[model samples]
Target chain A: MSDPAAVPPLLDARNIACQRGGRMIFAGVTLTIGAGQSLLVRGPNGAGKSSLLRVLGGLIPCLHGTIDRHAPIALADEHLALDPDNRLEQALAFWARMDGVDRERLDFALHHFRLRELADIPVRMLSTGQRKRAILARTMASGARLWLLDEPGNGLDAASLRGLGDAMAAHLAAGGGIIAASHFDLSHQFGTVVELDRR
Target chain B: MTRWFLPLVRRDLRLAWQGGGLWMPVVFLLLVASLYPFAVGPDARLLAATGGGMLWIAALLAALLPVERLIAPDRDSGIFDQLLMRGISDEMIALVKLIAHWLGFGPPLMLALLPAAALLKLDGAAIMRLELGLLIGTPALAALGVLTASLVAGLRGAGALAGLLILPLAVPILIFGAGSLHPGSGAALKFLSAISLLLVAITPIAAGAALRAGRE
Candidate 1:
């Protein structure tokens, strides 16, 4: 792994607090991850893991503190964030085109995720694992420098999990970073781990 | 850009065509118009007299039915989030969605009115008037529907709420749409045209504001 001090931090979260439904999920949480580094955030169910991911992705309003990023970020939540009625290729192409990524990169990303065969299928027909793979493909195709993945390993088989690990490693090698929140044992793949207690 | 609009519109049109649910509005329009003759008996004059109003009411209701589903699929699949994050201005997003909704729901409802008009024994002039009025009025209904769709996009029972919110706003369109069918009613046509223009002008602003607010 590259030296943390040598690279600027891609994400800086200082004293971040998030509350939902009058319950405090987490408070006074400070964390930072730098370029070419990965931070795995582990927490139990209903512990605001997804909430934190949303806040980081700029989807949900943060209740307190600051989150600074040095590069553009891509977020992949469990919901897949894709139009179900749309063909897989069209949906990914739309997002990729909108994000200014080249078509070649998009095709490569889809093929890498083993989704080239299913590209023409409507998203509603895809199995959970396939849908997750498609979401990952879109995220990879985004070409963002920082990735905030809620559950990168969810619904993936052993081979796909390894493929995901390889993708993350490749992204890091290219001066990109990942902030993955997963319950699985990803310590071997990720450079660092940050575990949170249930509130 | 054609790149954005064409693909989006084409995709939506295909979905609307294949979904089967999109035809419900057309069915409702015909059903509602068919009821007019039955309720008032087989008097040709009575049907003629009430045909315009019946058609307009049916058209309005038809336009209202399928609007809730316009944004529901996107919201459910999380595509709305991706759209918001695409860096397109909220106004443009609202406009694109409005266009899609209009093409999917509005155009078909207008087409469905033709058969209904024939069944109501509307003469050529009345049929022409209804068509013209629908052409102008449907766009406005679509704009309003888009605003309502966005407002209720995240709510339960959004279909009911969409109807409730849109029907009241549609009163002017209804009046004008019906009035246009009267022979020698230039003033009504002019009024309808003016209202249509006003709605077209104001709809973008309302839709844009609502989308921006919702995103924020």
Candidate 2:
């Protein structure tokens, strides 16, 4: 784990406003998270939770706001994001190559998420929980400082949920930041929750 | 700009080969050429006279075949979103995809032209002119195919719209490429090359902007 004191904060958002499909979703939001910190975005369905993550990920622009980040970020939404037809290992390996993740770290990330055994299977074969873990492994493998997860605990069983929790703890211990949007109560681990509403 | 550019191309080529119906365009080109003789009643002289222009039209239509699925699948599946999060620009992704698309369809279309020419009863000189015109023109077709796909990929009825969008952009290439078949028409070939180069230059930028807009 990297030392939090030595590492800079991973993300900052000030006076943020977001819109989707020509309507405003959230406005006047502000937050900052540094290394080893987590920001939990809590919102009900259609409350723009996913849209906020997309905006922060820079896939869409924020209507009125500013965000600053000191390091690269990773995102794992409901979508697998990996190539569906390719073997899971091959698909993850492609991102690993692009992300410059070393062999040792990649192997460790796979092991951490219990995906090492399913690595050779095609992504289309994985069950819902397994696919979720695989996507998490991809984010972990990148070794990015900030992780924007739309729903980190959607299809996981009890064991996998605990596994995800442990992984987030470990990531924070290693000076990474997390901004997760979930209806589930993960505030104990995340420590700071920002609630959104339907409007 | 990452070391992933080559790997990206390789992956796309494989997808185009295995999942993308890579041979469909070439097959369509052949089918269109084959229909020509039957429609014109198999008069060798008549087929010979009209064959080269018909082939050019077939090639233009063939270029449109791959447009519907070109960018829509990857864009819908979150691949581009993932790539964007990793700091890869849409421009780079579009450029690599353009190259891969050309490699997948361009050479195969040219190769199939030989048998198609024979089917049309084209003479050696006509075949050579057709081949030269295709060689210079297909890259532009490939570019236009991708550029249209990017623009229409996120829209409803993208497939139907893509055909309508690409036909107009392809008119210039068709005029020059088919025109080059006439004797003493070297100027047409140069014009075809200029049009092709312009298309090649503009597609990446336009497609990149389209991709970014589509995400919203």
**Top candidate, metric DockQ:** 2
Expressed as tens digits, the lDDT of each residue in A104-129 for candidate 1 is: 99999998899999989997799989
Instruction: List the candidate 1 regions with Cα displacement exceeding 4 Å.
Output: A1-11, A68-70, A83-87, A120-122, A187-192, B1-3, B89-91, B183-216
Judged by DockQ cut-offs, the docking class of candidate 2 is: medium
Model 2: per-residue lDDT, tens digit, A122-197? 9989999999998898898898989999899988888888888888998899888899999878524676899999
All DockQ scores: 0.37, 0.79
Instruction: Quote each prediction's TM-score.
Output: 0.86, 0.95
iRMS of each prediction in angstroms?
3.3, 1.1
Worst 10 residues of 2 chain A by lDDT: A1-10
Per-residue error (Å), model 2, residue B6: 1.0
Q: How big is the positional error of residue A162 in model 2, measured in Å on the Cα after superposition?
A: 1.0
